[model samples]
Structure formats: structure tokens, C-alpha cells
Target: MSVYTEVGRDQLIAFLADYAVGELVHYQGISDGIENTNYFVTTDKGEFVLTLFEHHDFGELAYFLDVMTFFFEHGIPSAHPAADRQGRYLKKLCGRPAALVMRLDGRGVANVASLAQCEAIGDILGQMHIAGQQFQSRRHSQRGPEWRQETAQRLLPMMEADQAALLKNELAFQKGYADLDLPWGVTHSDLFRDNALFDGEELRGIIDFYYACDEYLLYDLAVAVNDWCVDESGTLALRHYQALMSGYLQHRQLTDAEQANWNLVLRAAALRFWLSRLQDKLFPREGEITQIKNPDAFLKILQQHRHQPFSVDELQ
Candidate 1:
């Protein structure tokens, strides 16, 4: 079910020759991404990441590419999609869309163990949120209430009747408490630590913009809080949250409404990923190498958020 075509090798070589001639002699699947097929193309010029858009909307993807370009120009560390000779940010390959980008310099650290690392990520994300306001294109959140209802309906066919009911109940919980007054803007909906890269003490780049969309800005912060402040066991790591919130507030302060609504937003963020992982497990897309994330991780996150206070003092 691999979407890649060996037929494109010669054409790819021809294309790269213009931008990175005599550099890419070998290319192989890195296979790290859960959504797209990524290959690390090595050349005498340097390394680059070639990504094939898979099971994702091309229009949204194009918007994210423009977002990356804007962030990169504004001193945010990110991989801007490379334009082709015709000045196209996107290129057609083997009947699918593809893009080439400069390889980020660092590796994705599985955990943020140091306060400095957490603070650095928070600062960078704050900068991104500030800069995101400048972007004109706005995409509605993909996991909005309507999306949850539709996905639950689709998932019902694949799960036990009881499990489907449980999903419905969770969906209700989300809808009843949904916030209408939270700040809305572009967000990297998937801001897990794995999507962030670190080079020494510096945050080298944020990758994987496929999930970027217009949503509650605090939802983005909530996603980051869940990632940086939770241990593998799902317990709250208060110090990590402290450093992250401290650095984040240095750029933009959370409004009282945003703070008051933060806890449920965090729960909703947890529910969002939990439902996505469950759906992916139950009804995986064709041509996808389907592996489900640990749903318990987010469930634990939900539990931890239930008791945590969302006071200004919490922003240490």
C-alpha cells in the first residue's frame, strides 16, 4: 500500500539537479511520520526531507506552507517548503502532492527533562502565536464539534456498541462545556514534543504543519502544556508547566477568561487526541501504516487536568 512510485526516481533526480545538482545520490524512507511518507534525500549538497502529502487536504497543507514561510522569515526556526523552478510551493508527483524542505538541524527529543528546554519551547511557541496573527488565511479547527459528531458516527460502525456509547458520552462532555469566548487563531494542533527539535539548549525547529489550523489559541497552549508538563505515567509535572508558562507569558499574557477556561480546554485537547487515536485504531485509512497511539496517555492527562488549579500563580 506504499504510495511511493519508483518511476519518479529519474524525474526526481532531474528536478534535484537544478536545485541541488550532484548532491542527491541516494534517497530512502525515513518513515518517522504517522501521516505522510517521508524520505531523507542525501546529496553532495546536503540533506533534505521530501514529503508526500497523504490522507490530508491539499488546500490546508498549502496554507501551512505559507505559514511556515512567514514564521521562518520572522526568526522562527522552521522548515519552509521549497519552491520549484515555476515558483510553486507544491509539486505533483506520482498523482500525489509532494514538497521538499531543508532538513532541520536537530533531532526530536522524546522528553523535555530540563526547565530550560521547556521554557525555550514556550518562548518559541509564543513567538509563533504572535506571528500567526499576521497570516490572512484562516482554516477552521479540524476537530470542531461537527467533526467530533461525524467521526463518532463513523467510528460507531467499527467499535462494540458499548464503546461507541462511551464515545458519544465523551462527545457530549466536550460539547456541553465548549468555550465560545476563547481567543481564536492559527495553531499547530499537533504540538507534541516529538514534533519539536532541539539543538543543544536551542529549539532548532518545529516540524509537521499538516495539523495547522485556526482554533482556540489557548487550545494550542493547552496542547503544549499537556506535552511538556506530563510524565509518561500521566502525572502532572508542575515544574515543567511552570517554566513553560513563564516563558510563554513573557511574550503574550493569557487573559483572565483564557485562564478560567484553560482547564476544560486542556481536557478538550486531551479528548481531541484520544478520539483521533481511537478512530485511527478502529478505522485506519487505506495506504496508511496504521499504528495507534497510547490512548491511556491522554486519559491520564484528562484526569490530571481535573484537579490542577489554573491560577495566575500557576504561571511560575
Candidate 2:
């Protein structure tokens, strides 16, 4: 949701004319994320998010738009992609592939303060996974093991010997679990606390589906735990972790393989973010508002997961 491309007022008004959303009142650039150019668009009808795709092609963008529609139709609390008079969600805006989605109510929780909040996120995530089972479109995770390895190799030369070794070792460790059979489905691969909207302790919406893909269900849970149930020091908060798992299990129980490889998945999740952040920090794109998250944060998380592995029973 960074501003990579700038949109002029006149240009934006003309673009909005293609849709029935209403006359554009105002629009402001959103700078919380790093992938795409996003703006909070306000029109006479209501508020919406206008996203200009930075890297994705039209076909990829259409898949994501369909995924959002599928989630919304299945009772998942997510933004609905707006269509034009021609009933088309994809359009060319600012000379880039773009789409408009309804702006969900409530703000994203930056500093998750309660176990109840973690639980709520977990419950919703489980429901989302279940709903995604019926979605026919299949896209492999862009940040999966192969990407992690390639990224780590590229970043290795830029880091200290110890950091390079850790990166290599973690990638090797993740490879051991590559073929493990687990319940797989469409997953919100990046479900950090900031991606979820909370009205008090209840979750109002989950936004940012750009990273959604077909992946292991447990891996999705692991990614959530790595973010939502971790403290400032990147240590796993046991109570919060437990609450999250409990809530998820209420909706969909994990398979035997998932339970057995839970700790491994946690480590893999940590490694994924660590590598991505390092890449973003080292090779930042030219954006109007570029935010490079700290790679060290995920490094600490990876170290913790490596040193202190926990099981599903421990969370129970």
C-alpha cells in the first residue's frame, strides 16, 4: 500500500467516471505497505481503496480479484472489489493495472494487546481457509521455499559470514519438510497483526490479499503465530499462542502431519519473513513512500524458533 505511482486529481476523476462508485470527493495515498500503490479514495457513494498494481500482470490481478469476491461471498470479512458498468473489476489507471475495493470499517491493530484479539484473528483465519477450499483458481505461493532459497542466496553476499551461515542453515532446515503431506488450501500467506482490522476485541476485516496463495493450512497458522503471538523481542508469547491455536482448532482441526510438523512450519514462517525483509531493505524499489521493515526483527524470531521449538500439545 505504498505510493509508487502518483495520480493527478483530474486523471483520477476521469478514471472514476468509468465506474459507478460515484463522483470522487478526494483521495489520499496509503503508505503502510511496500508492494503496490494504494490510495484511500472517497466518493459520493462511500470510501474505497484504489490500488495500482506494481508488479502483478492483468491475469494475476484478476485471480486476486476473484479470490476477494470468493471470500466475500463465503461470509469472510474482506474488501469487495468494485466493478465497472461493464462488470469488469480490472482496469487501466495511471497506466498501470488497477482495481477499486470497498474500504472496510475499523483500523488495523498495530500493537496487539490482548489474547482475545489473537483468538479472534485465529478463528477468522480458520474460517477463511475452510471457505477457500472451494475456490478453483490455484496460484502457488510467490514467497514459497524456492523464492526463499533464491532470495537468501542473493542476500548472502551482502551480509556478514554468520548471518549468511544462518540464512543457509535455515533454508536447509526448511527443505527437510518440503514434501510433508499436510492439509493444503488457499491461504492468506501474510496475515500479520497489521493486516487485520479490529473493532475492540472483535475482528472486523482482513485486508491485503496480494500474497494469498495455495499452501499448507498449517503454514498459514504458523505465519500468523510468528506475527500475532510474538512479543516485541520476537519471542513467542505462550498464552497468546495458545489462545490463537485454540480458536483455530474450533473451526478446523489440524491433520496429524500438521500437528507433528508445527514447530518446523513456525521456523519456516520465520525464515520467510526474515529473507523478505532483508531483500526489501537491501534492494528497495523506488516508491513515493517506501517502508523497509526491520529484517533483524524476523532474524530474532527465526533464532527463537530454531532454539526453542514447541508443539501443538504445548499450546493446548
* Number of the top TM-score candidate: 2
Clashing pairs in 1: 23-43, 23-44, 24-43
Return the number of clashes found in candidate 1. Answer: 3
> lDDT per residue, candidate 1, 1-316, as tens digits?
1333332578678767546335567887653545676777777877788777765567767887887888889888998777766777777665567788888988777665578888988898898899888888988777866776787687778777765676676677678555568777888888777788888778889888878888888889989888788898777688888898888988998888887777778888877777777776666555433334676688677766655646545555
Tens-place lDDT per residue, model 2, 1-316, is 8999999999899889999989999899998978899999999999999999999999998888888899999999998999999999999988899999999988887785589998998899889988888999999889988888888889999999999888787877788766989989899899988889889887889899999999999999999999988898989899998888888888898888888998889888888898888899999899877778998999999899888887888768
Q: Identify the candidate with maximal lDDT.
A: 2
Off by over 4 Å in 2: none
Cα RMSDs, all models: 2.8, 1.0
- Estimate every model's Cα lDDT from 0 to 1: 0.75, 0.89
Query: What overall lDDT, based on C-alpha atoms, would model 1 receive against the true structure?
Result: 0.75
Given candidate 2, what's the lDDT at residue 98? Answer: 92
